[model samples]
Target: MYQLAPNIELLFTEAGDYHDRVRAAAAAGFSSVEMWGPTGVDAPSTPKDLPALKAALEETGTTLEAQLAEPRTQFMIPPWDHSEFFRKLDEGVEIARELGTPRIVVGSGTGFGGWKRQVQLDKLIEIYQKAIAQIDGSGVTLVLEPVNVRVDHPGSLLDRTSEAVYVARGVDSPSFGVLYDIYHSAVEGEDMRAELAGAGDLIRYVQLADAPGRGEPGAGSIDWVERLGWLRASGYDGPIGLEYYPTIESAASVRHIVEVAARA
Candidate 1:
């Protein structure tokens, strides 16, 4: 959470491959950059095969901020598949260990068909609680983000920071918490400043993108400075993950993001 070492995935336009985009981020003066989970490894980021990737990170001075993770396929359409669920969780933990990444995101996926609503919710909560324990003290936190169900992530379990906050409270462990994404809040018609101000404690990481286009902060209607000012004011001394797809070059938007959010 140290000022969100920038993630290069956002800058990936239709222009080039992910590797080239990462190189571009390094050239643009970022000391540390974030790469996607499975994409971090050259071909496959297995335990035995990650040394080369480590070399690459050492070479570029880029660190893995957090991974989007392998998705919730097992939980997505569950006949309540605990077997597949725990298996992927184990794999994800191994992958995180290999990458030296401190964070991995886990999603509480949609209905497993024919299950009652409360049943699904309880199941999800139970699974996440166990998952939290599985990754305990691994130097990694399984960050659960709240998305905008109205548009992008329909049927998403963790759709509000409040909900995420609740889950974090239930799990009640340092290994589990919420990764607050600002763009989703804006789209959901939340007062960005107020939300963070109220629940900053439960949040472990914070990301930004402006609504309407999920682009850079200043590019959209979000008052980047004012909102970020609140974070600093509220004692959020963590990385503010820049998970935006700028309508321009990736590095081109960094300075603007920093400057604008600096209240400059």
Candidate 2:
């Protein structure tokens, strides 16, 4: 069975604060969870009480599979000042260490308008290479997520999994890899098996919501059985993050995926 980690930012909100959500997830029988931004620099995600969050995770014996890097970087924009991103990365690493989180999810913000697509992608490699160096030996794996531009993240630079793989290959660090988000891939209309085959082991992390509405697994048209089978066949044995919005109650929302994943 594939281990599943519901996104705390979207799941278990009924339980109260971020730390309380962690406790709620554990009460609902989840031993793992993921979240966006530690300091709440990004919108839609609020600042977290790191110490309390750490305490809750320890109390629940829950593993924080991943958390997003703060102030999501925008490399393509002109006069590109990435100093803030680099500066906060150290802080992010320290927070991850305290929380016992394993991976930090990164993304390619909206593309630079004037540059060639190849140039922009190569730029990403250069940036992440420097990022990996900045936090060298921090025991943190940085996973680059390729978001879909179709329905969500319309101007995102890294929309294709293949392009992300290319960037990862260029970065060439064991600590650097890709976050193959199933919802984004499906929304972009890429062949899952082929992309997974191409990505191989560079897929350091995974997240999913359903396309059409970015809802829970069974809330959309995806064939969870076939998709999960392809994911299994791809040899990625990582925890899948349920980054979906629940149309139903949070506890009830996960039942479909929990059942499907057990058989997958």
Candidate 3:
């Protein structure tokens, strides 16, 4: 059986502090937890917060697997000048390094303008190329994710899974890989297993969130249990992320998500 981490971002809205959230996650029997944003969710998690988060992980034996840069806060843009993009990316690398986590989820912001769209493509590539080089010694990897434009994110600049993978390879670094999100990919109308296998050695992370209702694991038709089997069949034993919008209480939704995965 694989270890599943309950995402606390959607859980425990009643907690007042950041550490309270981690503590709740630990109490929930989750082996790991993930959250978005460095601040404004409560206190800004700085280099200082890492030790408390670390202690919570230690006390609970839970891993802090990943962190989101909060939507539209940092990085994630098309056609940004190389200097500006790399600067933000470097900051992300620093966050990952300080937290002792290996991966940070990268979002593609809404499309850019002024220059031809094609020029933005080249700039995006250049940003990745330059920034990834800086993290060579840091051991932090960037995982680019594609979001759906139809239901969840309509104006998302990156829609196709193939395009995201292409950009990942275009970045051409050992650490640069795509975070293959089945939910958004499914929303865009693609065979999840086929696309995942197509990624082969390049797929670094796999996250799950269902469609239609977009609730906990079995509340929708994502077939998470079977999909998990696909990941196993394909030889991926790494962390599987639960990035869903909760239709029920966050903690209750987590219980249900865990139950579904367990039954699977």
Candidate 4:
């Protein structure tokens, strides 16, 4: 069975703070959870009490599947300066170490206006290669995410799974790979099987939500069984983060996917 790590930022909100959400998710019988940023540098994701969050994880025996890299890297603009992103990476990795998180989700922010798409993609290769070198042997893998331009993230540079796969290939490091978000892919209308086949082993992490609405699995048109089957066929044996807004209570929101994923 595939392990499902609910996004504490969106799920279990009734439990109070971030640390309390961890305990709440564990109480709901989830063994793992995922979250947004650690230091709250990114908006919509408040700063977390790292020590308290770590204690809660330990107390519940829950694994932190992943966390977002701070200061979202928007590389394509004219005055492109990535100093802060590089500087804070060590801090992000340290927080990950404290929480025992193995993967950090990185993104290619809004498109660099006036730059050719191919050139922008190549630039990502250079950036991540340096990042991998910096974080080498840290035991923290950086998973590049391609957000959809259609619904959630407009004008984002990396929106296609194939492009993310290309960047991963260019980086060519064991420490870097792709994070295939099912909701984003579905929103972009990519063929699930074809994309997964193209991605192959480079897909180091996965996340899901119903497309058209970005709600819990059952709230959209995606065929959970078929999608999960394609994921299984692609040989991805990793945790699938429940990164969606809950339309109902937290526990009730997960029931559909839990039942469907059990057999998947």
Q: Which candidate is the best by lDDT?
A: 4
Q: Where does model 2 exceed 4 Å of error?
A: none
Candidates, ranked, lDDT: 4, 2, 3, 1
Show how many residue pairs clash in every candidate, following the order shown. Answer: 6, 1, 0, 1
Q: Per-residue alpha-carbon lDDT of model 4 for 1-264, expressed as tens digits?
A: 999999999999999999999999999889999999998888999999999999999999999999999887777655788888898998999999989999999999985678799998888899999999999999999999999999899989899999999999999999999999999999999998999999889999999999879999989899999999999989998999999999999999999999988998
- Residues 10-52 of candidate 1 have per-residue lDDT tens digits of 6644335554555566666554555555533322322223565
Instruction: State the weakest 10-residue window (summed lDDT) of model 1.
Output: 40-49
**Residue 122, candidate 3: how far off, in angstroms?**
4.3
**Of candidates 2 and 1, the better by lDDT:** 2
Tell me model 1's lDDT, rounded to 2 decimals: 0.67
Better of 2 and 4 by lDDT: 4
lDDT of 3: 0.69
lDDT minimum window of 10 residues, candidate 3: 39-48
Instruction: Give Cα-based local distance difference scores for all models.
Output: 0.67, 0.92, 0.69, 0.93
User: At residue 193, what lDDT does model 1 achieve?
Assistant: 68
User: What does candidate 3's lDDT look like per residue over 110-210, in tens digits?
Assistant: 65555565565565666667767877888877788888999877866678777777778789888888888778887888887787777777788777777
TM-score, structure 3 vs. true:
0.84
